[model samples]
Target: MENLAKKVRSKKLSTRVDLTAMVSVSFLLIIFFMVTIELAKPKAMVLDSPDHGCCDCPSYPDYGENRSITVMLDENDKLIYYMGLLESPIIAPKEIKYGKDGIRRELLKRKNSLLKYSSKSLKPESIIVIIKPSKKSNYGNLVDILDEMKIAEIETYAVVPEFTPEETKLLAAN
Candidate 1:
């Protein structure tokens, strides 16, 4: 009877699971993944100036027929565009709305015409665009116009700060 009591132990054993290492490994894996993730890059445009460095006088581009287009960015997403110069326009200045139907349509037409003349003896630098922004025009308008220039695949374009007096008068009357 003494041997049987000795065999049967009185102390009770408890079991515990340690989850500290598991949590540490999980956090490390999360940090590793977070650090390795790649972010999307922003879109940008490249602008080139027209200076050949021959003379001190900046050679002004000739405003020829079917060679240039002038766009005026006005208030409330309004665009006034004309071909040639601000004085004697190829076509008189016309007001148009933004988006696919209005400005985009005009641009596409001009692009198609330019493509047509490309097979002819036309200079590659024939299409020069002058973008004049009024004080009333917002930054969003400028971005949209730049985006449109990209969409149109315009080779050369310049952003002039202020419009001419005549252009301002035309906008006021428009």
Candidate 2:
């Protein structure tokens, strides 16, 4: 009876030993997986500009390919208040003041034009308002323009840097 009890205790010890090896292997696998995991990288959009010695001009895309509206901010950071499609003649600021009401009215006019052109197609959720502020422009002006764009429902937009392609290329080359 003493020998039989000893044998039973031995069996229990063997089971416990087997569980220790499995737990150790599981911990090693968790550490290996954590070390081998790759972190996500940030994404950014690249803008193509002209090479060296090129004139300072915004990259003009093919006409009517994509509907875009350009709003120029002067040295004072005030809006030029133009009401026209990209690459088309810009209406002078003297004709329209650079106020919130004026911007809202112009946006509505553009929306009306798009509706007339694509009556069967789905209405655009937002208009692409490209802002190009002068180098000497105030930062507050840019913020104001963004706020105005949001209020006018023309929130989908891009900001063109004041430096031209040639300028950027020169800086890069130097």
Candidate 3:
């Protein structure tokens, strides 16, 4: 034990690793990537507006009789739909439940009618639907309506901000 103690000498060894160069190289790599990386371009959904943005453009009649279906989204997930013009004597706003027997059925019925009444050359895209989401409606309501439109296989549908005052009154009355 005494010979081993005599043979042992106390000496300090530096175990510190200098990470300054490593950190500097890592920061340089990070900065290089940050500077060279290209920013991703955001994709947006294109929405069609009613106004053409040109005053000189010839204006069509209030209702073109293009055989459009007006789907009015009311509060509490209620759907009020009318065919053709809103004021047409034959067409009145009818509240229907949402499902197989709901808006999809109505749209299918209208689509079949359109196929029957319209020229044989006309395509399914000719069946236009105007979705009007009231102020009381929310994002989920709009999404549901859009989903229903897709489920019904409607190709041409426009989202309108508001409905006419008379339509509002009709919705309230119902």
- For all predicted structures, in order, the TM-scores are 0.64, 0.47, 0.66
What would the per-residue lDDT of candidate 2 be over residues 1-174, giving only the tens digit for each residue? 888777744334443345888899999999878866733345443434445547765453433423556666655444554435323445432223455567667876876676576677564333566777767668777777777776776645667866556333333342
CA shift of 64, model 2, Å: 2.5
Best-fitting candidate, scored by TM-score: 3
What are the lDDT figures for the candidates, one per model? 0.79, 0.58, 0.78
Write the residue-wise lDDT of candidate 1 on 1-174 in tens digits: 888877966687787899999999999999878766733345566555555686596464655656778889888888999987767777778888878898778877887787677757555444677888899999889888888888888767888887678888998987
Clash pairs for candidate 2? none
Clashes of each: 0, 0, 0
* Clashing residue pairs found in predicted model 1: none
Clashes in predicted model 2: 0
Residue 154 lDDT in candidate 1: 78
Q: What tens digits encode model 3's per-residue C-alpha lDDT throughout 126-159?
A: 5778999999978788888888888988877899
On the 0 to 100 scale, the lDDT of residue 89 in model 3 is 28
